[model samples]
Target: MSTETDVDGGDTGDSLTLALAQLHVDAGEVEANVERALAAVSRAADRGADLVALPELFNVGYFAFDLYARNAEPFGGETFTRLREAAADHGIAVLAGSIVEDLAATESVETPAADGFSNTAALFDADGERRLVYRKHHLFGYESAESELLVPGETLETATIGGMTVGVTTCYDLRFPELYRRLVDAGAELILVPSAWPYPRIEHWQTLSRARAIENQAYVATINGSGEFEEATLLGRSSVYDPWGVPLASSGDEATLITTEIDPRTVVDVRDEFPALRDRRR
Candidate 1:
C-alpha cells in the first residue's frame, strides 16, 4: 500500500486499490465462513489491495432467519475479534461485511427479545483496530422477515481509509438516494456497499449502484454474496464503479475476488468538469 504523501501529496486527492470479495457464504456455518473470509483477505493483500470489502452477512447466510438468534453476537465480541485478527494479519483495512448483532432493547421499544438483533457491519484498520460500526438502516421486508429480526440503524458513518474518505451502507440502503447525499455532504469520496442482494433483482442492484456513483460523483464499490439460500438465491454481481459511473470491474454469480484501482482525484476532476452537483436545488 502506498502512503498518503506518495499518492498526490497533501490529501486533496489520493488513490487506493480496493478488493471486492464476492464470496459464497454457507448458511449457519460460522467457522467455515470465517476461513473463507480470511482466505479472501489474504488473496487481496497479496494482490496489493489496500482495502478489502466483503459481502453482507458473510459469517452466516443472509436468508437464514431461523438462525439469527442463535448466531447473533454483541458488538466488539468474538466475531469482530476474529475479523480484527484477519485484518491485522493481512496488513490491510477490512470491511467485515454485515453481521447479526444482539443489542439491548429499550423498555418502550416493545420488540420481542429474540427479535432484537441489529444488522451491523464493522471496519478494522491494518493494525486490527476497530474503526467504525454501521448497522443497516433500511430493512427489506417484501420477501424476507428482516424487520422482524433486525433493528434499523440510527447513524451514518464515514471513515478515512488509505487517505480517502469512505462511506458505508448495506444492501437495501442502495435504493435510497438520500443516504448517499448525506454521505457526500459528509465529504465521502468513495462509498462501499456490502450486500446480499438476491437474484431477479439484479437489474435494480446494478442500476442503483451506478446511480449512486453518478449522482454523488464518487467511487462506488458493491460486494455481494454468491450462493443459493433455502428459498432465495444471491446474484453476486459485485462491482466497482468510477466517478463518471463507468464500471471498473464486475464479478459473476461465483465465488471470486474483484479488484480495481481507483483515483480519488478523478472524482474531483469529473465533478469540476460536469458541475452537476452544484446545480442541485433540493
Candidate 2:
C-alpha cells in the first residue's frame, strides 16, 4: 500500500502499453466475473500490455442492485486477492474496476457515511501490490438506485502508474469537471475512468472524456462494461483519448480489448504547447 504523491515516475524509457478490457459480467455471478477479469488480464499480458483496466463493477453487474448487498466483499476479500495474483502472474498492472464493497469488512479507511456499502475500485501495481483504492464519489440517482443503496466516497485517490502520474474517477463522475481539475492539480498525467454507462448517452460519454483530456492536457482512458442487464444495456464504447483530444483507440458495443501506447512526455508537451491549463483563471 505505497502512496506516491506528485512524484513523477517519468517516462520509463519506453511508451507505456495500456489495455482496456471491455468485458461482459453476469449479474451476481462473482466467480464467473472474477474468471472473466483474470482471463482479460492474461490476454492483455500476452499481448505485451504493461497495464490492463477492467470495466466498472465487472464483478457484480452495475445494474444488479439487489446483488450489491448480497455479494459485497471487503477490500482485501476474494476479488482483491485474485486480481493481485493475476497482476503478479502476468507481470502487468491491473485496474480491478468498481466493486460492491462491504465497508464493515475493512478497517483501513473510514467509511463515507454509515451505509455499509460502496462502489470501490482497486489498482494493483505490476508487482502485485495494491496501490490505490478509489470509491465512486458521484453516485447515479437518475434511473438508478445507486445513491439509495450505497454511500458516496469522500476522498480522491491517485498513484503513479506506467511511469506517469495517474488518477481515477468512476462512471457518473465523468460529468464533473471540478473532479478532473483536482486530479490535474495533483499532477495527474493520466486519468482512468471505469464506467457502467448505459444507452442513449454515448455522445455524453465520448464528449466528456475527450474534454477532460483536452482541457487538462492529459491522457484519459474510459473503460466501460459491455453487457446487457435487465434494466439497461451498457453502451460499450470504451476508448483512450490523448492530450489533444484525439482518439488513440476505441471500441464499439462489444466485449473486446482496446490497446494504446501512451507517452508520458505528451502531457508535458501538450501543456507547454497549448498552455490552456496554465492560463486557467479559476
Model number with the top lDDT: 2
List where candidate 2 sits over 4 angstroms from the true fold. 1-13, 109-115
Task: Give the per-residue lDDT of model 1 (tens digit) for 1-282.
Answer: 101011111222246888888887889988888788888889889988889998899987899999988988777667777879989988999999988887763223322244478888988989998777788889999889898888898888789898889999999999899999999999999999999999899899999999999999999999998778887989988888888888888877888888778887788899999999999998
Candidate that would win on TM-score: 2
Write the residue-wise lDDT of candidate 2 on 130-182 in tens digits.
88889999999999999999998888878998788889999999999899999
Q: What lDDT would each prediction earn against the true structure?
A: 0.84, 0.86
Q: Give lDDT: candidate 2, residue 186.
A: 92
Question: How high is each candidate's TM-score?
Answer: 0.90, 0.93
Candidate 1 — what's its lDDT? 0.84
- Cα misplacement distance, residue 116 of candidate 1 (Å): 1.8
Q: How many pairs collide in each candidate, listed in order?
A: 0, 0
Model 1 alpha-carbon drift over 4 Å, by segment: 1-14, 105-115
Model 2: per-residue Cα lDDT at residue 253: 78
